[model samples]
Target: MRTTDVVRAAGGCVVRVGAAGLEVLLLHRVSPDEWRLPKGRVRPGEEPETAALREVREEAGVLAEILCPLDETEHQFTDRADSQRRTKRTIYFLMRPLSSTTAPTDPDFDQAVWLSPAEALARLTFDTERHVVGVALRLLLGQD
Candidate 1:
C-alpha cells in the first residue's frame, strides 16, 4: 500500500467503569473545539493494533490493553502538513486501562480527560467516532 496516498491509523475507546458509569479517554485539540480518542498515523511496517497502543501511550500517556476489535472508520481528506489528498482508515479497538496514572503528552493535543460515556459520545466531533464508541460500549455491556 502506498502510505503517501492512503494513510492508516488506529485508536480506541479506552475506558474505566466507575460510580458514574463508563468513562472514556478523550483528547482535546490545542485550538479546535474537538475531542477525540487517542490516535496517530501508523508507521511503516507497524501493525494497526500496535499503533493503537502506542498512540494511546504517546498521545494520552495512558497504558491500556485491547479487549477486542471494535470497528474501523475511513475518510478521505487533505493532509494539513503537505496539502496532499489522502484517505485515512482508522481501526478502533475496545481497550481497558491497565493503570490509573495518566496524562497528556502529545503536543498535538492540549489536554486529555476522561468523560462519561454519554457525554463522550455526544462530544465526539464525528458521527463515525461516536458510533465506534457505542460499539465498544455494547461489547462491554454484552460481556457483563
Candidate 2:
C-alpha cells in the first residue's frame, strides 16, 4: 500500500442569518471553475482557529467571529499540481460576519456571493465541502 499522510488545514464557513434569511458565503476558485467556502492551508506555527479566521479575511475580505466548534472532514485525492495521491484533513469553523458588508479579497477567488444554505450545498463542487456547509448551517441555525 502506498503510504500517504493527511495534511492539516483550516477554513471558515461564514453564515449570516437574520431577517435576510440564512445566507452562506461562497467563493469561486481561481484555477477551477467551482464554488467553495473560503479556506486555505494553515500556516506554520499558527493555531487552527487563528488560521481559520485569517483565511476567512484573506479569502473573503470579511472579519468574522468563531461561533462554534470546528467542523472537520477528510478528503483523499490526487494532488492537482503534482498528481501525487494525498489526503487533506480540513478543519472548518462556523463563523458569523462581524460586518454587514463583505467581499472576496484573495486574487485566487474570482467571485464571492452569499447564498441560501440549500443553494450553497447544491452549488458546492466537493461533496465533503458540501457536507461541511450542511453541518455549519445546522449549527448556526441551532438545529444541531
Candidate 3:
C-alpha cells in the first residue's frame, strides 16, 4: 500500500477594532455563500505573518496593523479535489484596520461585512475557524 501525505498551508484572520467594540471582517464565498474571515494560502518563500497581512489585503482590500502574536489551527479534511485527505494549518493574527475605508476586491470575495463577535461566531461555517475567531476576539477585547 502506498501512503500519501498532503501538504499543509498557512492562513490569517483579519480583524478590526472600533468604538462599537471588536468587529471581525468576513467575506462570503462566491460559490457557497458561507461567511468567513479573509484568508488564503501562504505563497512560496513567504513568512506566515507576512502572508497573513498580504492575504488580507489581496482578499479584502484592507491594510491593517498586526497587533499580536500568531494563533493556529489544524484539521484534516477532504482536499479541494475531494479525493484525498488533507490537513490545513491556518495561522492567524489579530489586526486593526489603519482606516475605516476598505472593502473586498474582485475574485477573492463577492461581498464583505463587519460583524460583531457573536454574529461572526454564529455565521462562520467552520468550527476551527470559529474558535480562531473567538481567540482573536478575546485578544482584541483584552479578555485574554
What would the TM-scores of all predictions be? 0.92, 0.87, 0.83
Runs in model 2 lying further than 4 Å from the true structure: 1-4, 80-83
Give the 10-residue window scoring lowest on summed lDDT in candidate 2. Answer: 1-10
Query: TM-score of predicted model 1?
Result: 0.92
**Tens digit of per-residue lDDT, candidate 3, span 21-131:** 777888788876688777766776888788778877877778877877557877777767657877667777877777576677757478777888888899998887898
Name the better of 1 and 3 by TM-score.
1
Model 3 pairs whose backbones collide: none
List, residue by residue over 1-144, the lDDT tens digit for candidate 2.
Answer: 333455678999888875769999999887978899888877778888999999989888889999876578887778777888888878999888997776787888978888988888889999888888878766666796
| Ordering by lDDT | 1, 2, 3
Q: How close is candidate 2 to the true structure, as a TM-score?
A: 0.87
Ranking by TM-score: 1, 2, 3
lDDT of each residue in 9-28, candidate 1, tens digit only: 99978999867888899899
lDDT of 3 at 2: 27
Candidate 3 matches the true fold with a TM-score of 0.83
Model 3 alpha-carbon miss at residue 88, Å: 1.3
